[model samples]
Target chain A: MQALNQILRRIPVWAVYLLGAIPAPWLFYQGLTGSLGVDPIEALEHRYGELALQLLIVVLAISPLRRFLGLNLIKFRRALGVLTFVYVSLHLLVWLILDVQVPSQIWADILKRPYISVGMAGFVLLLPLAVTSNNLSVRQLGPRWRSLQRLVYPAAVLGGLHYVMQAKGFQIEPLVYLSVIVGLLLLRVPFPSLLNRFRQVDSA
Target chain B: GVGLAGMARGAAAQEALEPNSWEEITSYNNYYEFGTRKEDPAKYAHTLVTEPWSVKIDGLVDKPGEYDFQDIMSEMTVEERIYRFRCVEAWSMVIPWNGFELADLLNMAGVQDGAKYVAFETAYRPDEMPGVQYPVLDWPYREGLRLDEAMHPLTIMATGIYDRPIPNQNGAPLRLVVPWKYGFKSIKSIVRVTVTDVEPPTSWNVAGPREYGFYSNVNPNVDHPRWSQATERPIGGGLFAKRIPTLMFNGYEQEVAGLYEGMDLAKNY
Candidate 1:
């Protein structure tokens, strides 16, 4: 674990950002070349959203990975968060510009559809976290920034819900995403303490 | 994606209706028996042995027998039809289908007096169909239509696309094509078509009763529980194509609206 951390430290945070940027453009190139199958727009949208969820899971795993396994790769969490936001933004743009082009329908969908509504809400929550995912904001806000970034918990859950809701039928993929997100969240909160709190609440 | 013919150009009004090329019509379809993905059907459906296929047409039919594919083709008068195929998943395709009307097929089978609905079932060969291994909406995918809807001139039992034998992925030897309804209602690779008194359970409706209804008529006014079915992105339009407003009864309202007279479409939906 110590050896792994030493190697991870040697790799600069910019490396994470650079590596993260690759998938988005690679996906775009695939879409542009007509390689992303019959419906490129839908494929691109799903890919971007899935990538965002994947990164979110990774970011969520960091703390537990360090606390439980002693594999500290904390320096790259911000980069992962920013990259997740980038994919999320790309997914939204594809839906807005390419998939659902009508201006009226955009607002209607976000307002009316629970899945879209939750997805938009998740995006909104991520907006501030993304903006503050920097060295300057980290220094200025200190402990408060950590609290603000914790908004990812609800955002991640919403993102998973959005995925599950949008799926046509009972698809295992989306449910797996939601379960992983919830599982990671449960890992973050101490299980025994949570159980005790729940018991106390029940007794009260 | 190769061999894609150029854009659907409206050259002449009749010739203008040539919306999709042979490649577009053959590839990119939802045959869940093959797999759920659009490409899955084209990839996996090849395993299906379409040669010497037969359909067991029973239930209320006087001539209830396993009709051989070749014999059915020889008996029926096949014709070309350029129809707009709309999926429940908000995607559209213009397919040049070659088949005879379902009405003619039903008449040949001799629709008995008690026949109220026609329930169609897709072939569920787990060995041929890798997707049937997974319980994705009950195996041997089923779909149904009202006796009137089934007998509609527009309701065709498509055997071919682009005047060629229908590819295994695109339902091969025989399939249903009710243009007025969503694509799922047009069950693919049909083996059994039963005419009965009761409204038989459809695959999608059976799976997600609230989301997918029995009468899945393309109505822009009626919204899906999850998303608005008001618009659909045409498949041939490529990536940059914007979604167009979904037409009522998929532009077959003139022909099919009379079928649902005095019935609340929204309630049924």
Candidate 2:
């Protein structure tokens, strides 16, 4: 267990990213294979979307995880967030390219559909967060960086709402992810100073 | 009541007067793609391949024949019937479908005794079918009905939409098009039909049983667990349009209500 933890602790952030990308090629191959069972395109689109939501939750949980469990997954935060963006972009692409097909219909559908409108809102909110993910941007706007990252909280909620509204029913699975996001966000608020200091010192 | 029947007959008569065009038929759709977006399926499903088809009729049936595209459809009289397809997704499409009545074809099949329900299955193969690869829905599309429901006059096995042969994506060659129920109940691109004694679990129902029932009648009162079934926006109205109130059994309650007597839809659903 110690050796395993040590290996996990030492693995570079980029390695985690590369590992995540490993599924993209396989999914693409599956998309071609017709082995995706029932609805291949929808399957791929959903997989990308669901994983993106999961990664968003994971990224949101990082600070709280570090603060609570002394597990510094800080190195993975940017990569996870970026992967979330990558998947979200792919999700949007599938909707636009395969589902929408016609340009005029796409415009009208997005404008008219409330779920699509909210879903698009979530994607748009994620854009600045994705674009400004670099160290250069963080360094350039040091004070603003934290505030900008805060967009993820509402983005996650909006995304959850978008998915819920789309399903048009109470699907319990997505609700669990939403709960995790809420829990992680709740954990980040200023706790009792003694407990907070204790965790900080323990981590140090 | 007498006038309404005359009006319906008149409408049916007028339907025969002007055969629908392919553009009007193809553009209008009941597909639930685009997050159950009514208008999206016709657009997205253009890439589907509907040719080179065969339907396998098995299970409780005696013959269990593997029917080709030509053989099953060869003898049946094709007619243009304009139907108001009300989806469980709360959208509607008035399609001028070109196909024979399902009862005419089922009679040809010679259904035997002990056959209580009729189950339909779609062609399963995802390579040419990109939609199959997505687990967004359970694969090998399916829908089922009690034998009485299967034999209803309005139950049609459609081969074409909008006067032209059904586009490959729209369940070409043959598809079950029950006008009264939600779109999913009308299983598309049908490759299999079985007369089964047991109630066969269907695709969407298997995906989420509480939300999708086997007998998916178009009742506005019995809402899908997630969305209201009270209203549906008819297709061709484009965006920002008014949705007419959906009728019980899609306005076929008078004809089909007898089939569900003594059975509570709320529990059965």
The global C-alpha lDDT for each of the candidates, from Candidate 1 onward, is 0.87, 0.72
After the best TM-score superposition of candidate 1, give how far the Cα of residue B85 lies from its true spot, in angstroms: 0.7
Taking the tens digit of each residue's C-alpha lDDT, what string does model 2 give over B11-100?
A: 432333343345434544544322233235565676556566777887776677887778877878787666777767666656778888
Q: What is the lDDT of residue B53 in candidate 1?
A: 91
Evaluated at residue B86, the lDDT of candidate 1 is 89
Q: How do the residues A97-201 of candidate 2 rate in per-residue lDDT, one tens digit apiece? A: 654445675676667667777788899999999999998999998999989988988899888877776663334556777777777778877669878899999
What interface RMSD does each of the candidate structures achieve? 1.5, 11.9
Count backbone overlaps in model 2: 21
- Model 1, stretches more than 4 Å misplaced? A192-204, B1-15
Deviation of model 2 at A135, angstroms: 26
Off by over 4 Å in 2: A1-155, A168-204, B1-7, B10-49
Model 1: per-residue Cα lDDT at residue B122: 89
Model 2, residue B99: distance off in Å is 0.9
lDDT of 1 at A172: 71
Worst 10 residues of 2 chain B by lDDT: B30-39
